[model samples]
Target chain A: EDQVTQSPEALRLQEGESSSLNCSYTVSGLRGLFWYRQDPGKGPEFLFTLYSAGEEKEKERLKATLTKKESFLHITAPKPEDSATYLCAVSRGGRSNDYKLSFGAGTTVTVRA
Target chain B: GAGVSQSPRYKVAKRGQDVALRCDPISGHVSLFWYQQALGQGPEFLTYFQNEAQLDKSGLPSDRFFAERPEGSVSTLKIQRTQQEDSAVYLCASSFATGGNTIYFGEGSWLTVV
Candidate 1:
């Protein structure tokens, strides 16, 4: 069975503090890993997509890196407004018509001023 | 060229009632998806559509859940005989193609089964 697990269910960080979230997966074949940020009462907003090990992508203050079995989302100098639930998902195999994704339980981050 | 959009940002339905949620994908998008999210959990895949074809409905929890995309641009998710366990946020997303790695999502429709 394909499964995704995210560590640290919830985290509280002070403004300007930096932290990292982890996402690990077990699948028959690796295809793509995705990161999303979701705000309260809204759908997830896409952050990045890593297709291969050793690949990384960054946007704003967030950086996502991928390996053979896991992915990491690093937040640099996070602010209160940056607080949101971060989700990680993985597609079972290489890109195909059946691009089904299994997602982790997400890590909630709260940045206080 | 707006992003995906879902109707009735919030809906409250009584148990045993049937409800329909709608999703309008971005213009020209070929792939559309539906997901169900319980509070505090990540969204779970429910179904997938490519153009007017329903490709995958394996993730749907039960037979009560049915989704259709007749015209290929707008889609609807119908839940029959809603139960309290059916309560969740329904999310809709669309991408340029069925195999695209990046997908854009709508604000989602929150459903409450009373």
Candidate 2:
């Protein structure tokens, strides 16, 4: 069965501290890997999309890299406002009609100022 | 609206009662989806709609769960005889016609079955 797993169910980081979140997947025909940031009571906001191994993308303070079996989201000196649940999702590689995402239980990061 | 929108941000239903959640996708978006998210867990796919056609409903938990996107626009997810286990945030998402496109999510409707 296809599976997506994220490590460190919860992370507490001091302001300006850095950390990494992991998302491992065992799915066939990996089409895309996605990263999202979600705040309490709000839906997830798009962060990055990596299509293949060794691909990387960066935002203001977050960087996401993908490999064949897993993906990592690195936070660089995160701030209190950066604290939120980071989610990783993957979609099967197939026809254009197959667009559903399989997600892992997200990692909740709390950055204290 | 500028983004995907959902109605009845919160709902509380008695067990055995029915509830309906509404979703208005971004204007002109070709694909719409519904997901259920339990507390402390990630969103799980429930169904997908490509225009007015219901393309995928396999992820739906049970036959009591029904979704529709008639007229190729606004959509609704209806749960019959709500159960306590049905309590979760129902999320609606939309994307372009092509595959691998970024799927945008709405604020989500929080349903609590008592």
Q: Per-residue lDDT tens digits of candidate 1, residues B1-114?
A: 688999989999999999999999999999999999999888899999999999889889999999999999899999999999999999999998744358889999999999
> What DockQ does each prediction reach against the true complex?
0.71, 0.82
Lowest summed-lDDT stretch of 10 residues in model 2 chain A? A91-100
lDDT of 2 by residue, B84-103 (tens): 99999999999987468999
- Which is the leading candidate under TM-score? 2
**lDDT (0-100) at residue B111 of candidate 2?**
99
The C-alpha local distance difference test score for the whole of candidate 2 amounts to: 0.94
Screening candidate 1 with a backbone cut-off below 3 angstroms (N, C-alpha, C), the clashing residue pairs are none
Identify the runs in model 1 with alpha carbons over 4 angstroms from their true place.
A94-98
Candidate 1 residue lDDT tens string, A1-113? 78899999999999999999999999877778889999999899998988889999999899999999899999999999999999998877755533777889999999999
Q: RMSD in angstroms, all models?
A: 1.2, 1.0
- Model 1, residue A79: what's the lDDT? 94
